[model samples]
Target: QRQAMANNSRPTPTMAPNNSLRWERCSMDIDHLSLHCRQHSHTVLTEATPVPQWIDDRVSLTQVLEAMQASPMHVLDTEFERVRTFWPKLALVQVALPARNVLIDPLAFADLGDLGRVLGNGRPWLMHSASEDLVALKPLTEHAPTALFDTQIAAALLGLGSSLAYQKLVQSELGVSLAKSETRSDWLQRPLSAEQIDYAADDVIHLQALCDRLGDRLDRLGRMDWLWQDGQRQIAAGYELLPSANPHHEFRAAYKLPLAAQVRLVAVLEWRERTARSTDRPRSWVLDNATAIDIAQNPPRSGPELLGKLANCRAFPRRQVGEVIDLLASAEAGAPFQPAPAPLDRETENALRQAREQIDALAAALALESSTLCSRRLLEARARLGTWPPDCTRWRQQLLEPLVQATLGASSPTQNP
Candidate 1:
């Protein structure tokens, strides 16, 4: 969650027209609707059904779980702080079911494993820009969600901008501008103010209806199945590099370095990862990227020299500096550095330029973003290596491969490596 605090400011449950109300009684209270009202401001919120309940215990969680199971879909959102931690510190979780919306306080309720089971039961989970929420949900659920309906991704397929904000998306599609007064609030603090609670609730309050609208739009366009497949593809792609032994996988900018520097970078990053995990602190707090890269590039010969080289190294135990020095020495001595293959030659480089031009034209013609076709890095890699990423889905290949191959030419010298 972004710390962009401003002020934020629910619906009633009713029985279905044709179905009996035996199993679906509205248990959440809506008498305190002013809990969501703005006291100081004159802004009037749009009328919506589905009252919210503040849930801070196991009983409330069970109640919400049963209600969610009764509903066909649910909206989910989370508020967390990640300023100085490797993992998100989950503070609040908002779940909006058809019957009512509820807030889950993770700090007060420690055992949420059952709630996780409910979320992981293959029911559709509606969220906006779900990547970070997916990370936050993993620790609670013991696994990531398999069924996702990301409103942002769905909107993108409908020709809305790919990076649309949640508030903007709701306003554009639903015409309701959410107040952002609490975007930067400290969610971990106890005794949350009414304003804070309202702000957090606003995150998921409109999600259920928003998902329904987007779903209908996608279905009419005959792209609903494609969106579902793409959601799964996104989940699979996110987990691809997460389990890698390469500690430097997240440092995308560092990959452009020479082969030997890359190896040394990996060594330092691996040590940093272990240290951060052990201490439950951020990797930067242990040794930031710049300092690590400096140590890797210019190894320190002695303990005193290491101290001199790293002014910020005092944060960690002095013994680790000695260990790092030894690790660098071992790495340097164990292997003779060999550079990776060169980038595209002159002819291939020109062809790659032409390919990008063609891709841009194709994207414009198809009313899609260039990134929706393929990322620049992926295109460059394909141009250089003469092959696509193994994980590229069949749908994407159908759209991209023929054009790329035509641009590469049949007799091109850049064969698959």
Candidate 2:
């Protein structure tokens, strides 16, 4: 029949949509699997001899520009350390074009101006789990990726595993599992070992292919808007070493303190930041939370008495003794207060609880952790500002705001209403 002829004539490609071969799941042989992948794949990692690090360093930057110009879309990844703070310091940067992969050493040559422009050029940049990468690079570059795509966003919409690992995504789409040996490579070192180099290269090289496959599926599923909104939220959140953040208002009743009490907390917070930066120690070490609370509760004036009160605190280094004493004096004099964590009433709570429910529902529908998508602080901001989460300003507003409205609309029937 005509239908039979039409079905038969729809030609299957020599390989897959990603140009990687579909290995017949039979005898389990890693060698056969690698062979199957390379023969039919256009992926960067499919190269028999992986170009781990950039060779011929003199013209490498120029070559990267050229390689990137031809291929407008590249994948980027980074490694860094930030166990102590909210932001990670970008230690290494990896860029993968469709045809090449190279890892940049941030420590060796800190100047990445050209590279930053290239990344920020409004060309689409793909990353998996992009939040950490965005935070790490904020200090180093003026512009983040202007056009960003998160493959994890796409995978979630496709009904794939909600928490897809990087390696699994590559394997699921590209049919290759990268070497696990270099999972902990210290990327900041120069003259990277062969294993480390290969691992780093593999980290980025497969991203484009994964993005392509996932992006196509996203388009087909009509979920591209979701991914776009998700990326925008992260892009707006930014990465900066803020001098001070108020933890006092973080508590419920404490937020209702008199203006002077609030001012005291802020002054103490500013002092803590200054001390931490000057000493290059952790913020908590500079002044423990309990100590800050105590200082704010009872404004300690100057001299031997104040010093003796804090004598039990061994963390107060000799270098900071004078500074700490001065900060106490400053707080005691006069401190500027910031008002409003949230209005203290049932109405505000209703609005906030509503925002939280919407966020929770949307997170479930999209298969991401709610906390990961939007924090409680952002939820409070939304309630106080009478707006949805910032990312909801875009395409997601229609989809997500309704749930927020439902939250704000009616109290529990169990209430006196």
Candidate 3:
């Protein structure tokens, strides 16, 4: 224990650890978690190094910063509520060092720039299913971590399931089963119960251990670079606040539509996206995708017909009807119609299946998942065009290029259906 500092109304500054990095978990008074929990004031006294250190004020936050400065790498996780807002409400931020775990209450403390700096400092962060957490990181620290070691992605690349739960990953890798009782609790509420705190702490508490195990497996398999590249891709995706193109353009229905209908769907979907952000509501509340499809396909010219179709959708506000009707009426007039190619015939299906079989055989030879080798969607598209493998990462292309060329080169007329 070292450093004498102010013992303000909130919990006093945790005893800053020496360079040895001996972090400890300590109890804090719950009544002082700011004015948000002023109504539910209570005194809590405990002595357990395993319990997370509750940080809700400036002094405690400063101490955490000091600890992070000593240790470049840390485990991180967040509890956020996204049901009611366009951006997630960052409720609690859990950060873990080898010897200590601390929960930072964003609602209580205002300045987290220090914590944000540590996150963005280009050090490796241990995380699980980090896409959503990266989004949640911004409002708290103002920046997402630069480097990541995502356990979920690493597990998938190493032949574990593509999408694995945090608890299951921990259990499989470390043989520890975590409790899920607080799975649906309102994280924004205060003061959080002891059980809630324990559960939140557990999310990050075991993550570092899993990262170590997964990293070892990937190292032995010599896919560490692959994991790093994939993690970077995941981080880049998290940075995209909106769709890369008109959101409707990604839908299967949009592709099946005539070019002019596709154009109209694009316009309405963009409108819905903008309205959803402005109103801070779900996309469905602004306009459902099914309704957008109907509007594009039918191209209702009259206001009565438009109203009749959308009449059942109460959330389709009447105030916006005039603009929507006018837009729908004129949607096809200027746009040129380009017909989509016919659906794949039985012969094309057979070709695609053969191409897929070749890829699967290659993937098995390399001891990798077929999906990991290349997505089925890309394979199917490329088979139609006689391009075996679609564009991919340089490392991935290097692995699949020879096999893909051989597969396409070997398909003779005799193999045709």
How many clashes in each structure? 16, 0, 0
Cα lDDT tens digits for candidate 2, 105-147: 6765647677666666655567887777887777665866554
What's the C-alpha lDDT at position 160 in model 2? 70
lDDT of 1 by residue, 31-145 (tens): 2111011112222233444445777767777888888776655578999998777677889889876555677888987588888888877555678887777777777665555
Candidate 3 Cα outliers beyond 4 Å, as residue runs: 1-49, 140-144, 299-319, 330-342, 345-348, 381-391, 406-417
Residue-level lDDT tens digits of model 3 in 323-389: 8877766665333434334567887676667767877897787677889877876655455555432
Local error of candidate 3 at 172, Å?
A: 1.6
For model 2, give the 10-residue run with minimal summed lDDT.
29-38
Model 3 C-alpha lDDT versus the unseen true structure? 0.66
Ranking by TM-score: 1, 3, 2
Displacement of the residue 52 alpha carbon in candidate 1, Å: 2.1
Clashing pairs in 3: none
Which residue segments of model 2 deviate by more than 4 Å?
1-49, 83-89, 156-164, 171-185, 239-247, 251-260, 274-282, 303-385, 389-393, 406-417
lDDT by candidate, in order shown? 0.66, 0.59, 0.66
